[model samples]
Target: MDHIFSPWRYAYVTSRKGDDGCVLCGIGAAAPSSDEESLVVARGDQAFVVLNLYPYNSGHLMVVPYRHASHLGDLDAAVLAEMGRLAARAEAVLVEVYRPDGVNLGMNLGKAAGAGIEDHLHLHVVPRWIADTNFMTVAGETRVLPEGLRETWRKLRGRF
Candidate 1:
């Protein structure tokens, strides 16, 4: 038998119980000193790349525009373009650092669409490998990530 200890996630799970405000906007507004804590990996002029604090995988990242817009129709063409560019960069960084079998990229437009933070638009860059999904996630309702978010940030931060 084996056990996975992720005590750091306790704070996140409990703290977000009834949290308000747009998380993406808050991260965008955070200062450089807060990068590690916020899990922001890279910042661009129009958009930025950040790690999902409660990630599906070890390198699950999100490319988000700085503007606080929920719908894709609300974003400017430049912001949309930059988001794509940043997604590409994120994929490259994930490949370089994690070397997964493949990657999953997507966006959830609204709460009904499975967007946890439906008020802020973000594209998820989730790295995947063969046989990565297991009983832990399906049967136990638990995710087994290979590495911690902070360590993943350290590996990907300089690359972006």
Candidate 2:
């Protein structure tokens, strides 16, 4: 019924860059992985937290190990524990801020398993709310979010 951002900016804002290279690797190089704009919330020795640029939801973040490996077997115990801990932390933060009714916490191992970036071992933490699904995603090929990425980041970062 009402609008927040301009309609003209919507395409550019929501549009994901479809280049002929590895997006995950590019993200790692683009910034220090600690900047909020880079979508890196918090990081430790073995792993780090990064927001999924192409997200299922606004607060969708990826908990990934510092080491670049494709499969779960490649990750060590520390890295695995780091991923698990970060996932739990992300869930708590999202719950505290957005109060989502449910969460989609898991990782797609391979391409067949729906791992968009299968080459990189990472876990996705997607926040889900009641009545979040709609025709926009099903029909319009989009997911209209209520808040901007910066706004969502600001709210979620406080919990970290």
Candidate 3:
């Protein structure tokens, strides 16, 4: 069998930083100058778009409000509206940059609902294509991405 290597994921899979603080909140609080390192592509008044560190696809992004809110109902109308706007912008940018066959927008609300970060509510904007999932994901329990995060951030940063 041929081996598919993704050495970058080693840091993610082995890191204990998830115990330090809320990752989303940390990214939200980071300075604008650090956006590239943080994988943040766009910022708005209420929400910002950042590429997923462990993405389902090349351009998988999350639109997160700066505030730490566990649930959607906890947010005010303006924040909610801005999150929606950011998600829309993310979709447009993903289409323009990746030419995806389709896109998936979703939110995993809590630990029971598949949220990796349960305390911070964020909307996911995932670029999808036909046959994007293959045997590697099912048989090997791994995902193969054609591009890296920095490249994805570079391609999407200016569009948003």
Stretches off by above 4 angstroms in model 1 are 1-20, 135-142
Residue 16 accuracy (lDDT) in model 3: 23
Off by over 4 Å in 2: 1-22, 29-34, 135-141
lDDT tens string, model 1, 80-141?
Answer: 99999999999998999899899988887775567767777889888878777662263343
Per-residue alpha-carbon lDDT of candidate 3 for residues 30-137, written as tens digits (9 for 90 to 100)? 789989988889999888998878777789898999888998889999999999888888888889888989998888776666777778878878888887765226
TM-score between candidate 3 and the true structure: 0.84
Question: 1-160 in candidate 2: lDDT tens per residue?
Answer: 1111111111222322224354454455444644666666776667777766556677877887866689889888988987888889999988877787898877777666666666776787888766666523532434566667777667666466
Lowest summed lDDT over 10 consecutive residues: which window, candidate 1? 1-10
Model 1 lDDT, residue 100, Cα: 88
Please give the TM-score that candidate 1 achieves against the real structure.
0.84
Pairs with steric clashes in candidate 3: none
Pitting candidate 1 against candidate 2, the one with the higher lDDT is: 1
Q: What's the CA error at residue 41 for candidate 2, in Å?
A: 1.3
